[model samples]
Target: MRRLMKLGAFALVLGLLWSCQDSNEGQQPQLEEVPDEVLAQVANLGFNADEVKMYDGVLFIEGDIRITLDQLEKMSPSDGLPVEEHYHTDNLVTGTPRTINVYVQNMPQKYVDATDIAIDRYNDESLNLTFNRVSSSGQADITIRASPWYYYWFGILGSAGFPENGDPYGTILMTRGYYDNVSNINGLATTIAHEMGHCIGFRHTDYMDRSYSCGGSPDDEGDGGVGANHIPGTPTGPSANSWMLACGSPEGDRPFTADDKTALGYVY
Candidate 1:
């Protein structure tokens, strides 16, 4: 009788294992379909159909390019030939002498000061592009806000949206804890400036070869019929001093290099 009881216990354990496996198989998640409009926009920007994927409601293209459905809907149609490795959205803010009013919200005093310093750097150049601080969020053209927690799982410093269809570019989102933990104030300021470059439609200087700054294999975002454009007069190779470099060093403080100024002058 004891021998029979041991065999019965083993059989019951095997039955439970099979039940769990069946449950897991039934619970498998399905892939969400990419919206037609979103796919068209991505294709227009040069991404192939296979390169674009929709997962968990977020659209991923070229591996690193993350877009929301709302943002995809807001983008304007693409135009112009690829120019310097600097990437840009087809949508540019209107008016030659554009006055972009920036509203700072929810950031600590230090970050606000850092943002002001960054704005001053651009204004000091006396280019056609100008950024002014405004007290009211409703009256502002660009809104800068700090995230309560780190949102970029990849350790990115910050991110900004591009100018789209008549919208005042997009909001700038900065990582709160990352900035708070940094000892160098200038490096923090550089991060703000880099994201600002994106706000104005500037892609990373090392967009073609991220290894220049990121120190890894050359990261080709992807081969879209439309790749990064080369701004007239900008260098063809890697630039160390560019404010728009993809990676930043905690000890490094970067101002606009000559090429960066040239690119800015050419665009704005």
Candidate 2:
């Protein structure tokens, strides 16, 4: 199954994938251009290295998740998960209230507003995580920027990375066509919150099987050695309407469902 209109966190790279099309390698060209070392490293992490691609001089997996060479070289691997539960990465922002300052660059007004909506949804919760959008990029801990290029493929929504060293992933790159393609601000807000979920260490609620949310084929987004540890207290069965599902639809409007809150609270 392909993760539709999904994005990811940075830590996933040297370690794993943070994307909308988690298991389905996108139809984008230039797979041949990605270096063998990149492919080998991605493969080592349990991703589909054969589907890896190069975009705008950056290595991307699944679709838009960036994998830096420096990070690749420094990455270490591991494994071991709870029998059944929600998932998150090993590295997470540390604190009772992990307040993340967000900044947007060149995003449409709709997306800017959607970011606020998503942030509010997170802040309203009693979890340890909180997001506050800053007017200046310099004042932010995470900067969300619009991709320089427009969307030419079907599921090209956005991309990101996982948290590292007790800090939220540094940046989130929204595909330029996202605002235009999604049906409403909440859909965009869902996408925004989803990517942030990766930054703060949340994995897809359906990580074990992308086909659960995204149809096509059943695929597991492997742990990538970073650990997709199950969050305690979350359901062992499917979580309906979670913002962190592997994919987002054009009209999708999921906003912090009850189980999502449980996952957030359990992790933080």
Candidate 3:
């Protein structure tokens, strides 16, 4: 039956991802969580271990998510103040020291291409960014995989990268395949930049907190602040022109805003 076949396919995908789903089901490993010392080591890289712990742990991500257009419409853009362009490498934080790669297993090639282009646009010339297979001793930046979910979506919500260890190391990305059926994939670049921004210790430019001196609606301002945290002139654009804005809005400009550069300089 078609239902049975679908279940079989789902199992197959899970097997490939975990390699030991059956044998290791419910068998939690006894590896140590990131320690304070480890966090201190990457303090300059961005990301706080304590904060990351809120989301860290074995995750059962259903790469096969199904979000309806109505659901998409329901999701609101984050409400927070934009991050001021004042990234301090000294203030960076982290948990463990590891790198991850992203892949879009069943996603379309066009989405993949779009992500690559976004990376090219954001990375400075000195970065010389490129994607390749991850290796233990080679270049294992991050590995992204395309999802098999008919309705694929990505965001900080399900991503474990934020609450992860290391000095806000990078996370590679890919898209789910079936959604690839549709066209006009304009959001891919915005998605990548948004996610990558998290990896580099940049929070949502519009993260809001009422208790702070920069008071306003909580999370009303985006993570990137007025001019963006970049070197002067390098990340030219309106503070609001970043690609990492809330959903439903047209994509932000391609170039990195000042906040973006300041964050990058903090880590790299």
Q: Candidate 1, residues 99-140: lDDT per residue as tens digits? A: 888888877777778778789988988888798888889878
Candidate ranking under lDDT, highest first, comes to 2, 1, 3
Better of 1 and 2 by lDDT: 2
lDDT for position 193 in model 1: 76
Write model 3 residue lDDT over 102-128, tens digit each, in one string.
Answer: 343334467567556655655442332
Candidate 3 at 200: error in angstroms? 2.5
Global lDDT of each candidate: 0.58, 0.64, 0.35
The sequence of per-residue lDDT tens digits that candidate 2 reaches over residues 1-268 is 0134433322223122222322244444433377787777776664546446565556666554565767656665652221112765555677656678999876668878988998999888866777899999888998988654423342345677766777888888775543455557777777788778777766666656666776657767665565555667777655776776766564578888777877777777
| Worst 10-residue lDDT window, candidate 1 | 1-10
Q: Rank the candidates by TM-score, best first.
A: 2, 1, 3
List runs of model 2 lying over 4 Å from the truth: 1-32, 35-37, 46-50, 79-85, 150-155, 224-226
Q: Higher-TM-score candidate among 1 and 3?
A: 1
lDDT of 2 at 129: 72
Query: Best candidate per lDDT, number?
Result: 2
Q: What is the lDDT of candidate 3?
A: 0.35
lDDT of 2: 0.64
